[model samples]
Target: MNITYDWNKGVWSNLPLGVKVSKLHKFNALPVQFSGSYEYNFANAAVVPEWSVNLTVKLLFPM
Candidate 1:
């Protein structure tokens, strides 16, 4: 799931909004797979960062 909104024309309370979510996991015999993401921002601007998180681990090699 993801949603984002951004504006840069003039002052409208510094309109910038963003949201993101992600998840993935697989384990049936331990091939290893995991994923995660989270992000949120509501800009008031000073260098743009409200909240952010991400994690991922995947190890599956079969050829």
Candidate 2:
């Protein structure tokens, strides 16, 4: 399974100083992997993106 998401904030400045870009992605596999991104403004030199990792746990049920 795979999933992706994004979010943006409203404009709060004439220079678009309050602009925000975010992204979240995930994939279901052995060890679940995920990544998160964050960026502001339109300057390629001022971009900030982050990544994350997650692991899936198995649960056992008893009858």
Candidate 3:
């Protein structure tokens, strides 16, 4: 499990990026992994904020 928070308001007046969370899981001994993450942006107030999710699969080969 991993979590991150980014506060760029101090550096940039219009920057207010919020948070991101991610998780990883192993499927098998074959070196396969599943990972997902969620991100949010807080800079825009006029627009509705929605959570975005991303997923990816990883495979590794060992010699």
Candidate 4:
């Protein structure tokens, strides 16, 4: 879990609050892992999105 906040004077209300949540999963039988995240912005801006999401996969090789 994660949380973020930002203050911008140029933006509306002088605040550009944001929140993010993420998760990670790992398998014991396999060398594969997965992770995902979601973010939301609570600022009235022209170039910012209200919500966003991301996903990632990783493979671990044994040496």
- Model 3 TM: 0.43
Report the poorest 10 consecutive residues by lDDT, candidate 3.
Answer: 9-18
Residue pairs with clashing backbones, model 2: none
lDDT of 4 by residue, 1-63 (tens): 233334454444223344444444457755776766765655544455666676777787767
Total backbone collisions for each predicted model: 0, 0, 0, 0
CA shift at 49, candidate 2, in angstroms? 6.9
Candidate 2, which ten residues in sequence have the lowest lDDT sum?
Answer: 11-20
List TM-scores for all candidates, in order. 0.26, 0.21, 0.43, 0.45
| Residues 1-63, model 1: lDDT tens digits | 333344564433233444444445457745766666665555544545566676777777556
Looking at model 1, which ten-residue stretch has the lowest summed lDDT? 11-20
lDDT of 3 at 28: 67
lDDT of 3 by residue, 1-63 (tens): 223333654332222334444444455656666666655644443443444567777786658
Candidate RMSDs in Å, in order, are 8.5, 12.0, 6.5, 5.2
Tens-digit lDDT string for candidate 2 (1-63): 122223354422212223223333334433332333332333222232222233433333335
Report the candidate with higher lDDT, 2 versus 4. Answer: 4
Query: If ranked by TM-score, best first, what sequence of candidates would result?
Result: 4, 3, 1, 2
Q: What TM-score does candidate 4 get on C-alpha atoms?
A: 0.45
The most accurate candidate by TM-score is 4
Error of 4 at 32 (Å): 1.5
